[model samples]
Target: MIEIKNLCHSLGGKLILNDINLTLPEGSIMGLVGINGAGKTTLLRLISGVYSADEGEIFCDGLPIGDEKARERLFFLPDDPYFTGHTTGKALFELYRVFYPDIDRKVFLEYMSEFKLDEKKPIRNFSKGMRRQLYIALALSVKPKYLLLDEAFDGLDPLARLSFKRAINQAAEEYGTTVIISSHSLRELEDFCDSYALIDKMTIASSGDIAERVNRYCKFQLAFFEDFSEQIFFGLPVISLEKTGRFARIVLEGKEDDMKKALEKLSPAIVEQMPMDFEEMFIREVEGRGYKV
Candidate 1:
């Protein structure tokens, strides 16, 4: 488990992270969402012990964050990973072996072969996509209990992303590893994350089960048999409404059953559920907060 209590941090003179409190239980996968410069990267740094917190403390399985024991159980991969020019993929594995102690040489070799990554060649010569693949492969090989990934999918192609998701899901399912992944790609995060946290204005704006949060927002597409006064349904429990010549599209907040029965009296042509994907959910959420998702 990861525990962050009253965590605060600053840089130069400005606050980077406020009194943040977050707890991630073991064997859970969490997606972290935030706009650019909204303390996403800095928060990850603080958690990984790259920077010390100005106030409060962070712990992993009751082990102090950044302590030697905590460091042994954590693997944090940044958006921009640094690799020396002369290091090969094999050399990287050897380096991790010395530090991680549990690095799996066989798994690393298998990944290098599976990804078609040349272990003999210097890592500096690899493309951005290849470098990302290398880090992901290496991180998995270490088999850490807590994994922190920042923008893990930034440079991958579709096939690579599919492979990455498959690997992540397998890790969560098999070994009970708790993963905290930060990304701007809500559409992608929605595919695998069971829950998410939205950080805004230097704080956690919202955090909860993805399904529960999405279900709170109800969307409907209404079609009328005849010209019914659209204003008749006005002032209902709704967050937004859209009107065309004959049909009205609306979003409400409540149970679909109660809503369906309530609209039965209208006798509309069609009242159906509007499909909402992860991207749509995030867009509406940020838009509701007066920001672009």
Candidate 2:
């Protein structure tokens, strides 16, 4: 498990994150999401010990993250991982083996083959997606207890995305590896992550099971026989509403059954409840905070 308490950090005399507290259980995959410059990377760095916190403590399985033993159990994959011009994928594996002595050579080779990467070739010759595949192979070989990934799906084709997701799921199921993945790809995250944390305004705006969080908001498309004003949903826990002539699309926050009944009372010619996906939930969340999404 990972626990962070009273976490605060600053850079160049400007506060980036403050009073942040989070707990992640073992063997679960979590999606870390936020807009640009929301300190998502900073928080991940703090957890991985790349940057020391100005205040508060971070623990991995009861040991401080600064502890070498704790650090050994954690692997952090930054958005832009570093590789020199002459660094070959095979050479990278050897280097990682020095630090992670338990790194599985066979597993690494297997994944490399699956990804169709030439480990003997210089990493600089590989495209962005290929490099990412190489590093993911390395990560799987390391088999750390906790894996931190930033922009995990940035440069992958659809096939590679499938392979990546498959590998991550396999790691979690077989090795009990806990993962925190930061990404702008909410749809993909929604498909795999069991839970999510939303970082906004310098802190965690929301975090919970993906299904439960999405269930809180209900969406509906309604068509009326005659013109009607938006005020019809003024007191119905409306999160967002769009009206065009006699057609309207609305999202309400309440029990689904209750919201549906309330809307039914409005007597529309047609009322259809639409499924709300993660992307829609995120848009509504930020929009509720006065963002013009």
Candidate 3:
């Protein structure tokens, strides 16, 4: 398990994150999400020990994150992983082996083959997606207990994205690896992550099971025989409302039955509840904070 308590950090005299706390159990996948510069990457860097916190502490499996033993159990994959122009895929594996002595050559080769990458080819010759594939193979081969990936799905086509998801899922299931991935692709994250943390205004605005969080918001489409002003929904817990003529679509925050009952009071000819996905939930969340989304 990973524990972050009262974590605070700053750069260039400006505070980036403040008083953040989070707990991630073993073998769980979490999506780290936020608007640009919301400190998502900064938080991940702190947890991975690339940058020490200015306050508080971080722990991994009861060991302080600054400890060598704790660091050995985690792998941090940045959005732009470093590789020299002359480095080959096989050479990259060797480089990782220097730090991770137990790195599995067989696993590396297997994943490389699966990803259709040439081990002997210089990394400079590979495309962005291919380099990402190579590094993912290395990550799996390292077999770290904690995996941190930033912008994990960037530069990948649909097919590559599927392959990457499959590899990550297999690793988590077989090795009980704890995974935290940061990405702008909320739709993909929705399908892949079991839980999520939303970072906003230099802190975690919300964090929990994705399904439960999404379930809290109910969406409905209504039609009325006569035109009605939008103020008719004044008392209801409306997150967003779009009205045109006698038809309106709305999202409300509450139990499904309760929200339906409240909307029924407005006497609409049609009151149809609709499914709310994670992307919609995220949009509503930020919008609630006065963001024009």
Candidate 4:
């Protein structure tokens, strides 16, 4: 497990993150979500030891995050990973092998083939998406206990995104790799992440199981033959409500069964429940905290 306690950071005399605490377990994929410039990448960099914390500390397993042994068990892939000019994919692999002596050349070759990349070709000539794929393959070959990826799905088509997700899952299941991926795509994160952390106000505002958080509030669409006042649902734990004539869509905070039973008491002509996904939950959460998206 990774433990962060009272972590703080600053750059150019401006505070980026403050008093942040987090616990990430082994073998689970976590999604880091936030608005642009919310310090999501900065937090990831701190955990990876690229930027030292100005206060508190980070522990990987049991060692301090900056320790060589602790660092050896993790790999950090930045938003823009570096590759020298005219560097071939094979040369990249060789360079990585220096840091990760156990780098699996066979697995690397297999991934290159699967992604239809030529190892002999210079990475400078590769497209943005192609370079992303190559780096992902290298990360897998390193087989670290923990993996950190920033903007992991930036330059890819739908097919490539699917492939990347599959590869990440495979790594977690097969090698117990603990992965933390930062992305703006909530839909993509919802597809695979077991949990999420939301960054706001220069700190980790919230974090929890993805399913439980999204399911806490139930949404419903209601249509009544007779008119009804919007005040009817005021007594209930309504998060948000919108109405059009006799048709009203409401989001209430409660379990599905209980909320449905409560809405049924109103005896509406039509009552249909709508599923709330991660994106909606995120928007509501941040808005509740007075952060405009």
Candidate 5:
């Protein structure tokens, strides 16, 4: 497991992250979601030991992250990966092997073949998507204990994204790789992540199993028999509500059975369960945080 306790950091007098605390266990895929300047990248950098934690302790499997050996078990792929001007994909693998002595050359070659990425061309000439693929290949080849990826799904089409996510799941199941990926795509994140953590205002706003958090709220649509005061439904246990003519769509903060019982008492003409997607929940959570969602 990885533990980040009271993590804090700043750059040039600007607070990039503050008092961030998180616990990530092994053998799980976590989605790190946040807005552009919410410090998702900064938190990943701190956990990977690229940027030192200004205040707090970072531990990996009971080993202090300050030790070089502990850091060796972690791999971080930034938004824009750095490589030598003329370095080829094959050469990149060799360079990585110098640091990650147990690099899986076979796996690297297999990924290259799967992605159809050329290994002899200069990295400088590779397209943005191609470079992203190469970085993914390298990250998997190293087989680190913990993997951190920033904007991992950028520069990829739908087919490629599907293939990438499938490969990640395969690797996690087969090799027990603890992976944390940061992405703006909620739909994509929802597909692969079993757990999640949200960052807002330099602090962790929420974190937990994705399914559990989503289960806490229920959505319903009701068409009243006649014109009635909309305030009748207010504060019954609602996260938010929208009204259209006689129909009202609401998100209730409780279980399906209890909510159903309560709504039955209202005796609406048409009552049905409404769909609640993750984006809507995210908006509500952020709004409660006093921000414009």
Candidate 6:
């Protein structure tokens, strides 16, 4: 497990993260989200010990951050991983093995073959997606207890995305790899991540199980037989309402059955509950926190 307590950080005298606290359990995949410049990268860096926090503490399985023992159990993959122009895939793997002595070279070779990558070729000569595949292979080889990925799926094609997702899920299931991924691809995150931590206002503004949060509220599309105005839903607990002629779409705060009963109280020609995926739920949540997007 990873525990962050009252964590604070700043860069060049400007605060990035402030008094933030989070707990990520073992074998869980967590999605970290926010708008650009919301300090998503900063938070991940702090957790991975790339940048030490200015205050508070972070621990992994009871060991403090940066401890050699704790460090050995985790891997941090930045958005743009650094590699020299002449660094081949095999050389990179060897160098990583020096630090991660438990790295499985067989698994690494399998992944390299699965991705159809040429290990003899320098990483600098690989395409963007190819480079991502190389790093992913490296990550899987280490098989760390905690894997922190930043912009994990930036340049992969659709098929590569599926492969990466499969590999990640397999690792999580087999090795109990706890992953905290920061990405702009919310839909991709929605597909695999069971929980989420949303960054806003220099702190963790919201965090919870994704499914529970999405099901907490629902959207209903209603069409009234007679003429109806916005005043018709005046007393109801509506988070948002939009109108188009006699048709209306409203997001109400309640369970499906409860919302249905409430809507039934007002006779409508047609009413259907709409489904909200994780992305929509996240948008509403962050918007509630005064985030423009």
- Model 5 residue 171 CA deviation (Å) reads 1.5
How close to the true structure is residue 145 of candidate 1, measured as C-alpha lDDT? 88
What local distance difference test score does each model get?
0.84, 0.95, 0.94, 0.92, 0.87, 0.92
Off by over 4 Å in 2: none
Q: What lDDT score is found at residue 136 in candidate 2?
A: 96
Off by over 4 Å in 6: none
lDDT of 3 by residue, 40-121 (tens): 9999999999999999899999999999999999999999998889999989888888999999999999999999999999
lDDT of 6 by residue, 1-293 (tens): 99999999999999999989999999999999988898999998988999989999999999999898998998999999999989999999989999998999999999999999999999988999999999999999999999999999999999999999999999999999999999989999999999999998899988989888788889999999877879988788787778998899888877889888888888998989898788877777776776666
- Residue 119 local lDDT, model 5: 89
- RMSD to the hidden true structure, all candidates: 2.1, 0.7, 1.0, 1.4, 1.6, 1.3
- Model 2 scores a TM of 0.99
**Which lDDT tens digits does candidate 1 get at residues 1-293?**
88989988889999878888898888888999987888988888888999999998999889998689988988999999998889898888888989987798887877778778988899889888899999999988888888899999999888899989888888788777788999988888989998888888787888888888878777888888667675778657766667886788777777877776676667888888886666666767777788843
For model 4, state the Cα shift of residue 237 in Å: 1.6
User: Across residues 1-293, which tens digit of lDDT does each residue of candidate 4 receive?
Assistant: 99999998998999999899999999889999998999999998999999999999999999999899999999988888888898999999989999899999999999999899999999999999999999999999999899999999999778889989999999999999999999989999999999999999999999989999999988999999978899888689887788999999888888999999999999999889999999988987877788754
Candidate 4, which ten residues in sequence have the lowest lDDT sum?
Answer: 284-293
lDDT of 3 at 35: 92
* Colliding residue pairs in candidate 2: none
Global local distance difference test of model 2: 0.95
Q: List the residue pairs that clash in candidate 3.
A: none
Lowest lDDT sum, 10 consecutive residues, model 2, at: 229-238
* TM-score, predicted candidate 1 vs. hidden true structure: 0.92
* Model 4 stretches astray by more than 4 angstroms: 226-228
Which segments of candidate 3 are over 4 A away from where they belong? Answer: none
- Model 5 misplaced regions, further than 4 Å: none
lDDT of 2 by residue, 76-143 (tens): 99999999999999899999999999999999999999999999999999999999999999999999
Name the weakest run of 10 consecutive residues (lDDT summed) in model 6.
284-293
Which prediction has the highest TM-score against the true structure? Answer: 2
